[model samples]
Target: MGIENILSVAPDLVDEVARLKSIEECKILKEKIFMNQLTKAEQEVFALAIDGHSVSEIQGIPHKEEFTIKNQKRSILKKLNTPSMTEAVQQFQNLHQEPSQKLIRTS
Candidate 1:
């Protein structure tokens, strides 16, 4: 049986499964970040972007010129192999979501 089927039969194990899944996702994200070899600035821009910050908002917080921030965002997208910021953010969110949350999304 699938994990979802098993989890459905035993709701009490849901929290433990979600917690372990979260830990595994964190490790996966860390590995991907490291493998991408993003520079510090690129990493910072990426984090801000995924956190829902617009370029203008990021500029004010990072004290960077808009042009520079835009460039870094572009670099981040390229490194992540995402076509756009929206896609990158979606992928990031999917990676961090709990198993139950993912099921809810599909439904």
Candidate 2:
């Protein structure tokens, strides 16, 4: 994706935040955001990546260490099929921002 696409999505995210409807909806979004794209650990790294974290900084996310974090980063990029950290972040954002992908909770 290009910078233009990223900018276009920012407004949509803002709309989403401003329009919190229900906890069920939130849960659905989380389920969909992760889906098959990442494991919980990789999802954590993706969050840190979005926050502009360094490899060392990502490693130090409370319970995580350098080796595990580094490994997760590589895994996330591979799953995202992105060649760089920046591209991974962008793809992550794109995947999560779309409400159409929301997952249904089953009993």
Candidate 3:
């Protein structure tokens, strides 16, 4: 269920996760989509969703209307190739395993 377990079971996913590095370049984003076939917009909207925004809140920050925000979310789900936003974001978060100092580790 943990990230290390995922990496062990599927190292390719780990390699895929490295694209999230802060030091990564914009060109890499293009490569990830054009070459690797990963969903770029899904990743962005996924991050926004993780930050706890309602569709209206998301629209506010992005300066888009609610319907547009909803459309973007739909597009994001399609690109991520998931049935829903929750599933896509959850899998992306689980797979990427963003390092957070604010988090407490019990293990």
Using lDDT, give the best candidate's number.
Answer: 1
Worst 10 residues of 2 by lDDT: 98-107
lDDT of 3 at 95: 38
lDDT for each residue of candidate 2 in 1-107, tens digit (9 for 90 to 100): 99999999999877665555443476566557554578987877877788888777777778777788888888987887888888877765665565542443322
Give the higher-lDDT candidate: 2 or 3. Answer: 2
Instruction: Please rank every candidate by lDDT, starting with the best.
Output: 1, 2, 3
Q: How accurate is candidate 3 locally (lDDT)?
A: 0.57
Clashes of each: 0, 0, 0
Q: Estimate each model's TM-score.
A: 0.55, 0.54, 0.44
Tell me the TM-score of model 2: 0.54
Q: How many backbone clashes does candidate 2 have?
A: 0
* lDDT string, candidate 1, 28-89, tens digits: 76557553667888878878877788767888864688888878888878877888878877
What's the lDDT for candidate 1?
Answer: 0.72
lDDT of 3 by residue, 3-104 (tens): 888768786665445543422443344335432343555455556877765655677765556776677788777766789767765755553343332232
- Weakest ten-residue segment in model 3 by summed lDDT: 98-107
